[model samples]
Target: MFEQSKKYFSYILNPMELLRTKKVLQVNPTVASPRAEPEEIKIFVFDYNAAQADVRELKTVPECFAFLDSPKTTWLNVDGLRKVDVEKICAHYGIHYLITEDILSIGQRPKMDEIDGLVFCLLNMMYFNEKDSAVEIEQISIVLGKNFVISFQEDAAKDVFNPLRDRLKISGSKVRQNGADYLFYSLIDMIVDNYFVVMEKLGEKIEGLEEDIVRNANTRTLAKINMLRKEMIVLKRSIAPVRELVNGILRSDSDLIEERTEKYFKDVYDHILQANELAENYRDMMMNLNDLYLSNVNLKMNEVMKVMAVVTCLLAPATVIGGIFGMNFENMKWLHTNTTFIIAAFAMIGIPLIMIRIFRKRGWF
Candidate 1:
């Protein structure tokens, strides 16, 4: 666990690695990898309604135009972002250049905006990287159009959309029966649901750290506490703005979001609200943990001091007797006599015994 924590913090210290498009990692664009492993841009399409679904991967940016005007609800899941490809797809889909800029910008805060006929949402999608036992954030920017929704992710492979895609594949499912708004809701709902997963893992770690602090608080424990506090802050930042994003969807007057889908988005709003509360609680708990660590350290220090005081008291009689016997005067009683020396030795040992007995009786360490 300590090793895992060290590795995790190494990633945390480098904010650029977490916030920017992964340009160095090789991830298969067709399969989902951890959020850290996306290198190239890829696009996936899920087009469906109540009757049937068309699922395929696009090799070029222009392929997306075919679904732009299709009667079926179309969801373009862009895995990674190349500036040129993003500009081309956004232009073809009638998306504003500014929204495209937001997509290209990898670190936008969680927010919602309405431009012309499109409703745009940008939020961080949280993932727990099991390999390093860390929380990873990927920015997802979604644009809801007349009959289409486009999701842009900085990572090429990592997402919480498989189950949602599975629902789209299932005939007669609510996702298939509903319009594009419901599909949009499902996408946001999946993102919100993953928030709980990541938070639950954080809660478990917090609980574990609390126990560890109580049992044995050490420097490593302090490090872990600091690390957790940092993680909590990140979670809070990512989660707090999302409440507004979800609420914006609920309060949006965009025609892209139909009346019937408001309830689904409302459900998502409730979930984000719950996640927000959890983040706040974790933040408070982290502060409490720091205090607890200091208290424990002080308590341990006091224990050591108490033991030293008791030992010093026990040795005081011996020190005084030895000091008396060392006198240079020839008239000193036990200076040269064996029996007197033995008596002095016994007295030195016996006095400390008595003092210890009295001390124990008084409950003084």
Candidate 2:
């Protein structure tokens, strides 16, 4: 787990690698690699009304466009952006190139923008990868229009929208009676709600680290604390912009967002705020854990130093007596008899005992 955390922290430090886009000049257009074959795009289209609903898998962009023309509220979920003709899809939906650029880019900060009758939003979705034992972040871009809502994701391997899908399948679900705007809000809410799950995992790791620090303060424990601190920093960076994005949506005057839907967004906005607060609390706890670990190590060092000082003090008088007796001066009285050696031995042992008693009385030990 510690090794996984270290690897993830390194990735967070250099997040550009996650995007795989390179800009050659200051004003040059960004270029992406075309070497790798793109994964086959899977499209899920849902046409639903107040009473009934239809869900289908679209094989081509034409199918997606045809589904958009339906009278019912249409939801087009495009999974896997690689090797797909994104330009044609954006053209069909009236999405601007800038918005498509943000969609294709992997490392975009969470943001909301309105342009030409479309509400464009970029969000970061987080989930814990149990197999890897690390937090994984992916960008989810949403485009909301008058009659339809489209979503783009980088990978189709994992998604947090399954619950929302289930809710849509039920006839009496709140999402069934609402329009496309509500569906957009529902999608955002689902993404934000998963933040709590990631935070819960992070909270668990923080508590575990706290317990470990108290029980066995060592270099490994210190390393784990620092790794958790890095993870929290990355999480905070990811969530802070999302709060601003949601706040912007709440205050937006865009026609794509209805007045009724604004209240739902406000709820999501509150969730983001809560997530940020929890992250801040975790960050502060990590710092405190680090300080506690250092204090424990310093305390141990001080104890060792105290013992060495006492031992040195007790041996000082014996060293002086030995030095005086080894001198060549014949006038020394104790050096003329065997009693001198015996008395010297007694003094060596007796003086240290007396000093030890003095030290004990003074509470030095």
In terms of TM-score, the best-performing candidate is: 1
Residue-pair clashes per prediction, in order, are 0, 0
**Worst 10-residue lDDT window, candidate 1:** 20-29
As for candidate 2, its clashing pairs are none
For residue 18, what is the lDDT in candidate 1? 45
Error of 1 at 285 (Å): 2.0
- Tens-digit lDDT track of model 1 for 75-165: 9999877777888899898899888877776456689999978999998888877665567788889899988889988765677898888
How well does candidate 2 score on lDDT at residue 245?
86
Error of 1 at 96 (Å): 1.3
Worst 10 residues of 2 by lDDT: 20-29
- Residue pairs whose backbone atoms clash in candidate 1: none
Off-target runs (Cα >4 Å) in candidate 1 are: 1-40, 333-338
Tens-place lDDT per residue, model 2, 80-155, is: 7853567678888888988987877756668999888788889888987665335678889999998799999867
lDDT for model 1 comes to: 0.83
